[model samples]
Target: DTAVSQTPKYLVTQMGNDKSIKCEQNLGHDTMYWYKQDSKKFLKIMFSYNNKELIINETVPNRFSPKSPDKAHLNLHINSLELGDSAVYFCASSLRHTGELFFGEGSRLTVL
Candidate 1:
């Protein structure tokens, strides 16, 4: 079974449209993370949800947010999306304080 799974593998919408990507992990990890891979393929940490606490990266815009209703799931929601938001969003999970991360297939969002 896949350790992590994300829905809507591909997303395409207008610039101002809001969208979300759902992610679920069955590994029973304590932490779930959201990463954004830019066109250059550079991965940047966007948010981390651990034990119901959310840690947001300072560089992440307020328009991007992570909502975790439970430990096993973390969903990314972007409001009023912009052209710059077009990228591949990956969902990951890991044990508390661990270096190893299991990533999902990733959701590609294209804004026009």
Candidate 2:
């Protein structure tokens, strides 16, 4: 069984388009998060949710949103996607806030 899974592994779109990525984890963890990796391969956490409640949000632009329907799933939505949003988005889960994270395969987005 996959510990973490994300759908729409690849996405290509023009600027101003909106898109969403879905994630699901079977690790039985209480914490899940979304991270964005820039063109330079720098990863930054965008949101963290614990037991369906958001706990951390890194000053991400309003265009980026993270939604957790339950402990095992977290979905990300990007509105008016911009060129700067072109990068790999990763979904991760941890047993706790400071525990080791289990990452999904990642969803790569490209904006033209």
Candidate 3:
């Protein structure tokens, strides 16, 4: 069984369109996070949700929202997608706020 799973593994959308990526983890972790990796391969955390509390990175735009429906689920919603938003979004989970993270395969979004 997959530890974590995300849908629409490959997304091809035009600029300005809105899209959502859903993620679920069965690792029984208390913290879930969303990390974005740009084409340059630089990975940065976008958001972290733990016990219903959300921490958003200052660099992340308002258009990107991370939702934690439950302890085992974390979803990302992006509005007005732009060319700069094209990248691999990864869903990850950790046993605790400072625990090792387990990441999903990642969802690649391409904006045309």
| Per-model tally of clashing residue pairs | 0, 0, 0
In candidate 2, position 23 carries an lDDT of: 96
- Flag regions of model 1 displaced more than 4 Å: none
Could you estimate the TM-score for every candidate?
Answer: 0.96, 0.96, 0.94
Residue-wise C-alpha lDDT for candidate 3, range 23-78, written one tens digit per residue: 99998888888999999999899888886578555478899987887889999999
Name the regions of candidate 3 deviating beyond 4 angstroms: none
- Candidate 3, residue 60: the lDDT equals 84
Q: Tell me, by lDDT, which candidate is best.
A: 2
What does candidate 2 score on TM? 0.96
| 1 versus 3: better lDDT goes to | 1
The pairs that clash in candidate 1 are: none
What is the Cα-based lDDT of residue 94 in candidate 2? 93
Give the worst 10-residue stretch by lDDT in candidate 1.
51-60
> In candidate 2, what are the lDDT values of residues 1-112, reduced to their tens digit?
8589998999999999999999999989999999999988999999999999999999999998888888999999999989888999999999875779999999999999
Total clashes in model 1, counting residue pairs 3 or more apart in sequence or in different chains? 0
